[model samples]
Target: MKAVIELNEIKRDFLVGDEVVHALRGVSFTINEGEFVTIMGASGSGKSTLLNILGCLDTPSEGVYLLDGNPVKKMSNNERAVLRNRKIGFIFQNYNLLPKTTALENVELPLMYNPDVSASERKKRAMVALESVGLKDRMMHTSNQMSGGQMQRVAIARALVNDSAVILADEATGNLDSRTSYEILALLQDLHRKGRTIIFVTHNPDFYDYCDRNIILRDGKVVEDNRNKVIKDARETLKTLPEED
Candidate 1:
């Protein structure tokens, strides 16, 4: 399998007052295409810093980062933004949908940033994305009118709108209840089966069971990197959950 993300001895530093803080210290990893990876760590563990660099939201102080074979470290700010917009999709724990926007409209927002997509094409793609997430019926509903799970589904649709090279999810299931979280995980698993690369960041150990690989971080360094021998099927797990009232 080809690698979609490659990090070579990446380092990130922060200037806190008169002292220097090393957020990432010589970390390196490669994530292959279609792999579902989970980055796990405690507070102050630099997992967040790693995610920021992987998502192209921040530059590393040292080392190389290649996204889809493109050297991210060599790009300027505008170039990085363009690369990020074209290749990466983000899903937040809070389901950052615009409040007054309908589900379809919210999903269409990402396409609006692309100069290559026209209005009609954006709508067409957004509809397909929403339908894939089983949100076709809720297309016209606003955020306030939907449940938390529904909002997250809309967010997922938005992420899929660009057909990105990788989906970077930051605590994507953190805000949802257990059953709802499983549902979201099941959706992600489905996407993974369909060959979409996914990188998930979480503190919860339970979620690691569903991922193909786990990278543990501590105090700005990678403490462990392991490939999961037995990946749990989220869809099957969902079947065992008790029905909600």
Candidate 2:
């Protein structure tokens, strides 16, 4: 299978004045196309940093990153921006919506950034994305009128509106209740089934049940990388087990 994301000897450093803080320490990985991956880690573990680089939101401080076989390290700011607009979708813990913008407009924002798409085409694509996220009826509703889960769905719609090949989500269900989170995960699973590539960063390791691969990071390094384990039916087995006597 062809790799959708390739990271080689990647590292990211942050500057607090002259002091350098290492966020990613020589991490390397390849994510195949159409795979759903969960990156698990705690604070300062570099999972978020890695997601930013993968999503093209930030350049790695050192090492190489290739997205769809294109050398991302060589892309200029404008080129990277364009690539992100077309090839990558981002879902955040915070919905990051324009509070005053209606759901339709929010989902349309990505298309608005791409000059290649016409206004009519944008609306059509946005509506399709909204439908995929099961938010078509709430298209005209603004953020203030929606709940946390609804806002997150709107965000997912906005992410998918650009017809991006890869989706990068950071704690996409952090603020929602268990039921809502499960609903969101089910939507993501359906997208994965439809051949969309997904890289999701989460503090909750349990989310691995929804993924095809799991990447575990700790203090800027990977401690475990597993497949098959991601789809294990442990929860189902646990439900049938005897409780403490």
Candidate 3:
């Protein structure tokens, strides 16, 4: 299988006054296509730094980083932006949807960056994404009008609107309740079952069971990278939750 993301001895450094802080120390890993991966770490473990590099939001200070076999370090800034927009979808913990915008409109925002998509096509794709997230009836609802979980669902729809190759979720369930967190995880599992490559970054160890692989980071380096032998079925777990009021 082809690797969706490949990192070779990746390193990142930040300057704090006269001192240099090493955010990532020669970390390396490959994420294969269609795999669900969780990157777990405590604060200052370099998970966020690694995520920025993976998302193409920031470049590494040293070593090669590849996305879909293309060397990210070699790409120009414009090229990187294009690649990010076309290939990567991001889901944030805060459900970064436009507060005043309708769910459908918010989902359609990403499509606006692609000149190849016409207005009608953008709307069509956005509607399909919303429907896939089971938010067909909430298309016209604004972000502030929806519950926390619903807002997150709309954010997921927005991420899927562009048909991105990989979904990068950064602490995606941090703000939700336990039951709602499982619901979101179950939705992510469903997406993974359909062959979407997902890279989730979270500090929660319990969520590791839902992933196919776990990569634990410590002090800016990979401490453990192992395949999860016993994966939890989020859908089944959801069934055991009490009825939502």
Superposing all C-alpha atoms, what RMSD in Å does each candidate have to the true structure? 0.8, 3.9, 0.9
Best-first order by TM-score: 1, 3, 2
TM-score of each: 0.98, 0.91, 0.98
Off by over 4 Å in 3: none
What TM value does model 1 have? 0.98
Q: Is candidate 1 or candidate 3 better by lDDT?
A: 1
C-alpha lDDT of candidate 1 relative to the true structure:
0.94
lDDT of 1 at 83: 83
Residue pairs clashing, model 1:
none
Error of 2 at 31 (Å): 0.6
Model 3 alpha-carbon miss at residue 77, Å: 2.8
lDDT of 1 by residue, 206-242 (tens): 9989999999999999999999999999989988999
lDDT of 2 by residue, 180-217 (tens): 67667877887888899998888886677768888999
For model 2, which pairs clash? none
Report the C-alpha lDDT of model 3 over 142-173, residue by residue, as the tens digit. Answer: 99899999999999988898988899999999
Per-residue lDDT value at 44 in model 1: 95
CA error at residue 17 for candidate 2, angstroms: 3.2
lDDT for 203 (candidate 1): 95
